[model samples]
Target: MRNAEVARQLGVPPGTVSYWLHLDRSRRGECPGRRPPPPCPRCDDTPLDEAAYAYLLGLYLGDGHIIQHSRHRVPSLMITCSEKWPGLIDEAERAMRAVFPQNRTCRVRKTGALNVKVYSKHLWCLFPQHGEGRKHERHIALEPWQQAIVDRYPWGFIRGLIHSDGCRTTNWTTRIVAGERKRYEYPRYFFTNKSDDIRRLLTDTLDKVGVEWRVTRRGNDPYNVSVARREAVALMDRFIGPKL
Candidate 1:
């Protein structure tokens, strides 16, 4: 890593880290009676906005993952989004940057999807969702502070969930009434996930957001949350808007 990257990871000024790096071991002296410096800065030391953290956490739970290993490769946090929706990938990068400022981040180019990844040991501590198998095979719960953040910014958290595992689309249909056929088109927001707890968490937040959502089915999973009513769609659009 470069001086600026080290400074960012250490939460120190670039010049300070530079000064230390420029000095040779023979010339660099330590103060007496002072303890040795830490092996590395804590990942939690990276500053975080509660809402942003919660949103990233939601995305992590929905479609992101962490890889842990003792050798072969560095552990990393990775989130992949469809190539069709580059905006979501951009948002995920921003969110990851904000939360894991000290980690070395990268983007992987693929044929059908965009992947954002960061390497850090402290990331697992920040989010304990790492477990065996898929999320549905395990339980997803929130810490007290995370719950508080979600309570304050339910829409932001919901946005992350929707962007990761959900989608926005237009629905067109025709109905015949009184021998008259009426054609109409409407926009709807839908989220599908296999984790019952995640679906429940999303619905509970929607309840708090005052946006009514209905449970629906999709081929991916039987658990789904959808917003199709005119008013509900309007409300969801207020927060999530369109996926660019």
Candidate 2:
């Protein structure tokens, strides 16, 4: 059967059939270029937007994934964004396009969120942290080069993480002011991730940016990093405010 026919009948992407055929051909020593790889900063020395990359990196580590089929040459980078935050979805797509200006991006709806994805052969090159298993199951650490970018754009990086796995909330209490009872509101930031390494990365960046944070134990896992200090919350507000 023709590959396109098979793909159409099976409701699979045409590229999937092509990838399987290509793999069979390679076993017989026939090698052909399926698709030319897109330009990559690490491979082709293409200029990268350091700030955008820093932000995207944070998103990837928090709620993004690079999916590469074992038999396919092209891989897709997917960032899951909640439906409640339409602005965040747009920002995620924009950051991806900024990082790979020549590539096209798309959104796939799933459950209550959208998967903003872009396909390229160079995703692994750009995100070396891509590997088997969930991010929390593995040791997630940035390369020295990536760390430099984040250091240069700490706010962008923090914003990305906040957009994905963190949130800004208002905490309120009653206070007496001038002999009158008044409601006082405190704005705080919280970043929750199961991976200790990922949490450390956030805290480390927060420290670099002079944003004070403390680890708050939520349930059995101490997965919450809270920024409640007046100065720290103000800093977060300036750099990485509520998810709009």
Candidate 3:
């Protein structure tokens, strides 16, 4: 099948299918316009034949899952905190393949970090049946309060409730942009939520910034909403109108 057709059927981009095919072709020693058979059955320590590998690779390319074994097939050689090694990745892949012939198809990739200095010396096998690349989700914009939480924590913060109510009307307003521009209906709403002790930290920080906020129930009931909460909702309606 053509790359685009295969990608459309598999729900991925055509470039991804082409990349995988290129990787497969590279592994078969057919990169410079040479046609070679599929990779060997035991090429990467997988207990499957060439046909099985082809079928499994197809399934993997088509969004199939790769099962991981509970135990490591070959024990990893642990190297201590020795600073003598520079090209550890190349050295490790060579040593591993010498010890286990099937590891020839495996590629050594780097990951993880140390205290101040980064550490990288992990080896992973690239089986044709299980080498599909990863997918990444796009970053999304966060609400004002969520942005506040992210700014304070740099990791993440939780929100129990967010109340936003606003009204829309057809009106023209002029504003100075690069020159001058007109805008339609504007949005006027407020956001508030309950959190644990961590929220108390956020609340104290937000108070200094004139955010007009308060905390009802703290750590007692994380998800529980009390009668006082309804009063807060009513207050929001009074301050920020009745349409949301």
Candidate 4:
């Protein structure tokens, strides 16, 4: 289908209809002599380690992209982390290496950010989460084995979610104490994501850890999960920690 046809059918802009059409051209019964390309040299057959993979999967769902390489390109995995938290990027690199030790990992510089990228065809295992438009437009759920991994290392999963889509910071508000006006500050953790499934996963995991969180909307935007209050934040502090 053409870009304009897709845009009209899906009620989306033309630019949003990128790559799919371009890539599908190869699979549209194009030529009688065409053959599947040889396997990628960078691809690996590494076994999955549940705990580490759960953490990496959480990070991928939040900030990673598994690019499907074109006929002339190589498949690659990319995870973007904030430049402010070098540790988060380092852990991300570590997770990728742990998952795919045979592959080489590198960093790409983006404005105010750095991306951990690896060229490996094996990264296609994450294709389930890849889609058109944005994550909010797509539904994300864990596979049975992936969910089992998360069940064991829920905290690690939470860490990745908060590290990628959530933040820890101080929130201040003015209130009245004993009939007198006063101001106070508190440490809180806020997580925002367009995916309802991701939010539910975070909340369910938090519930398991006995850390309380609240859900609200920021204007007309996506759901915001708040781990405020001293008690709740304390629990998060012990388990989630800072992005670093």
The number of the candidate with the highest TM-score is 2
Error of 2 at 237 (Å): 1.0
Model 3 misplacement above 4 A: 1-19, 22-161, 164-206, 209-213, 222-239
Across 1-244, the per-residue lDDT of candidate 2 in tens digits comes to: 9889999999999999999988887666667654444678999998999989999999999999988779876789999999999999999999999999989999999999999999887888889998889888999999999999998999999999999999999999998899999998888999999999999999999999898889999888899999999998988888888887
Better of 2 and 4 by TM-score: 2
TM-score of each: 0.78, 0.82, 0.18, 0.76
Candidate 4 per-residue C-alpha lDDT over 1-244 given as tens digits, one digit per residue, 9 for 90 to 100: 7889989999998877876665575566454576544333224333565676778877887888777646636778788998999999999999888776666899999999998998765555544566666787878877675677788999889988888888998878999889998988889999988899889888988898788889878998658999887898998888777777
Q: Please list all clashing residue pairs in model 3, or write none if there are none.
A: 166-243, 166-244
* Candidate 3 lDDT for residue 164: 11
> How does model 4 fare in lDDT?
0.79
- Residue-level error in angstroms, candidate 4, position 28: 27
Model 2: per-residue Cα lDDT at residue 160: 92
Candidate 4, position 40, lDDT: 33
Worst window of 10 by summed lDDT in candidate 2 = 29-38
Q: Which ten residues in a row have the lowest lDDT in candidate 1?
A: 35-44
What digit string (tens of lDDT, one per residue) describes model 1 on residues 46-112? 3566677777888887889988777734578888888888788888888887776655678988778
Error of 4 at 158 (Å): 0.6
Model 3 misses residue 137 by how many Å?
22
Error of 4 at 105 (Å): 0.7
Query: lDDT of all predictions, in order shown?
Result: 0.80, 0.91, 0.34, 0.79
Shift of residue 24 alpha carbon in model 1, Å: 21
lDDT of 4 at 84: 96
